[model samples]
Target: MKASAFMYGLITGSVTAAVTILYSTPQSGSEIRSSIKNASTDMKHKLYDVKGKISDLKDSITHMTKEVKELVPEAVHDIKGSIEQWQLSTEKNKLRLEKEISAIQTSLAELEQTIAAQQK
Candidate 1:
């Protein structure tokens, strides 16, 4: 049972105890029956209230799930695009560095040839 139901039981029990003590006499059958009827009505109303709250909770969860499902594909697509762009940028940098190294090596070879001729 919910906290509210327990609270209701406590409240009803306290009230009944107080009333019976003050009266100091046994209740008639009709009085007992009426009190029971009222208690059942109260409990029934509380149960319905609890049910409504639970239904609202379920609806909230379903809505959140749908929103997440919709967002997942968009997030994946963005990540894939970012990865592809990163790979392309890395390839371009690599090619540029290779060309620069080849040019440097060629300049070094020409400098060495000139030095050898001078020595001879």
Candidate 2:
């Protein structure tokens, strides 16, 4: 049982008990009938209002779910593309750095050979 339904039942039970007590007391029949009619009308209106709110909430949730579904795939695709570009650029930079290091090593070896020849 839903919490709202349980609470409504509790309230209805309490109201029924109260009304029964009032009816048993020395009140006019006309007044008792009028009270019962008013209570019934109020209960019906409250139930209708609750139903309307639940329907609106359901609609709002459905709309939000659809919007999220539409956006998530596009967002994932954009992120994947960005990561691939970054990886490609990093690989290119690594290759360039390696070439620079090799050039520096070759220059050092040539300089060492020139110094040895000069010493001789």
Candidate 3:
């Protein structure tokens, strides 16, 4: 339970006790009546104050949730972009390596042909 709820419980218990005292004794009736209005009004203000604080806390949580929801998708898109760039780079390097290997093979064939001609 919330602290405000607990405070309300305590206040209600006190009011009950005060009423009990008022009925049990004659002098207590005048004293209880004198303070009852003030006590009830004070409790009303505390309740409204607690209610306002709760509303503010709820708004803050909702805002934070929205921010997190917005950020997560953006973060995922950014990671995907990085992965795509890395793949393109890897493909470019692979093609360059394949071209180099093909050229080396052609050079070796030419050298072998020259060696065979010389021997003939």
Candidate 4:
């Protein structure tokens, strides 16, 4: 008899608590479930969008790398050619300057000898 009384009290307490909780809730169960579903769907869409942007960024990087690979050798070859042309031009200028310096030295020696002869 004591066990039966204890079970009855437990059942009544459980029902009362459940009723209180259902009545005190703000939104209905369906509304909360729908909101959760919509939020999940929105998250999925955003995830897909981010993945697509990452793929595009990867493709852009790959294309830029290929272009750099092609251009670097060409740029190096052009620079080498320019250096060679500059060396050739400076060689010619060096020869011409040497000739002019020799001519100036010869004129100075002639003037020095003429002055000495006049003094004597």
Candidate 4 yields a Cα-based lDDT of 0.94
TM-score of each: 0.49, 0.56, 0.48, 0.56
Local error of candidate 3 at residue 93 (angstroms): 11
The residue-by-residue lDDT of candidate 1 on 88-114, one tens digit each, is 989988899999999999999999999
| Model 3 agreement with the true structure over 1-120: per-residue lDDT tens digits | 999999999999999997787778755656767788789899999999999999999999999999999999999999999999999989989999999999999999999999999999
Q: Give model 1's TM-score versus the native structure.
A: 0.49
| Model 3 residue 111 CA deviation in Å | 31
On the 0 to 100 scale, the lDDT of residue 32 in model 4 is 64
TM-score-sorted candidate list, best first: 4, 2, 1, 3
Local accuracy of candidate 4 as per-residue lDDT tens digits, 1-120: 699999999999999987897678797999867877898999999999999999999999999999999999999999999999999989989999999999999999999999999999
Candidate 3, RMSD to the unseen true structure: 9.5
Alpha-carbon runs more than 4 Å astray in model 4: 1-25, 98-120
Error of 2 at 115 (Å): 22
Clashing pairs for model 4 are none
Give the residue spans of candidate 1 off by over 4 A: 1-26, 93-120
